[model samples]
Target: MTEPKNLALRENKVPEPTASFWTIKVLATTVGETAADLISSRLHLGTQLTTVVMVALFLVVFVVQFRSRRYVPGLYWLTVVLISVVGTLITDNLTDGLGVPLAVSTGVFAVALMATFAIWYATERTLSIHDIVTRRRETFYWLAVLFTFALGTAAGDLLAEQLNLGYLASAGIFAAAIVIVAVAHFVFRLGAIAAFWIAYVLTRPLGASFGDLLAQPTSDGGAGLGTIVTSVVFLAAILTLVIYLTIARSRRAVPAKDRQTGIEEPAGV
Candidate 1:
């Protein structure tokens, strides 16, 4: 695939895939599930109102994210956290508010995700996050991410609630799937891009199942942590990690003279 043209910045719009990246991503997914529950169920805002408020907030943050020239850890991850919540809300709306079956929601989101990827590949000739330097590519990247979260939510809930697998079992299943993907990528030489996206999609379900395992009551086969406690703990962890990432990125950045002399520093998490 060709390199993205007219690249005004050295860094990709998205962060590099690192251990920290996956850590924050999974944390964000867990927060998405529990925080949505906290707002809609615990806080008495109702699903419909919470969705509207969150969508508005997401658009506002999204514009800020789009206007940035390079990845800013705080802004970038804020967008991710918000999008995660929005995605969960979308799936919840489908199943709870609209009375749609979890299986149907899962199927619909999977197809939508596939369609987004198809169009993304057709238009850009690539689906690598490393290539997300332009607005159009970033748009596709976020669309794919949104669909993955929604799809994962449906699939996780279908297994945990509908099929009576329970939250812990669902978490175990998705975790195994992620482990298999890692083995394929590291040992079997799966393509980096494919492995990354597949694992990315899997993390959503894994994180959601974990969140539910903590947040739901003991009768529901969970640990009885409740949504508020789970959301607070995860969000705090996310904030700490993002702060470290921001500091690390600043320290890794090269001086203007180095940039002018064409000394390219290797990218980091």
Candidate 2:
């Protein structure tokens, strides 16, 4: 069945937030946490060097992402994966390298994220990801992404270490929060942008706690899966999903035009 042209143009132009999107996001965030550990702890590169490497890789991926005319799932997911790792390292640095407490890091990142949103809204007058076509909006998007990851790391550690909740419990708490956000959005007419950012921030800790639960030693309340194994498994899953998305894109028609802007829109426009 053909979708209404207007609905196709206005509603479905941007990639729909489907099961696959969430799957890939969770896997990417898990990989982000584990991959950082793989580089810093397993390889003994130290946090500083690992952060440098991850940030450099993130830049390369971001360049590719920004250069793409439309949202290619593989490119978009790859950028997310890299940014997750880099963002984790940023918080880890403040906590480990500089000896800052998790509470302090969390508060700092929260403030920074709020500031980013405030400036973004003031300059663009809209915080909608659905309208992210301009370079300025893209910049704000990435900055917010970075802060979300950092804040998630700090918040997750605070729960796991400071509160003694353990990884499994922390993951459960975050998962519950995500559900509440979904309910608020769908049942209460919550704003789309607010719901999306709330969910996005929560996914970080959900993924981070899950990663810790899988990768930490059995004595540490984990299953002793190890960072390398966990990272590889999630990365493989992400790659498979990206490949499927790429092939699917080729089979679809040119995405419809946006009604509001009267422009050819990308899927998930």
Per-residue accuracy of model 1 over 34-66 as CA lDDT, tens digit each: 999999998899999999999999999999998
1-269 in candidate 2: lDDT tens per residue?
A: 34334322222113566788888888988998999999999999999999888888889889887766577787788889998999899988998889999999999999999999999999878888787665666778889988998999899989987899999999999999999999999999999889989998999999999999999998998879999999999999999998998887865644485545767867765
The residue pairs found clashing in candidate 2 are: 13-267, 13-268, 13-269, 14-267, 14-268, 14-269, 15-267, 15-268
Clashing pairs in 1: none
Q: C-alpha displacement of 1 in model 1, angstroms?
A: 14
lDDT values, one for every candidate? 0.92, 0.87
Model 2, stretches more than 4 Å misplaced?
1-14, 254-269
For model 1 the TM-score comes to 0.92
Best by TM-score: 1
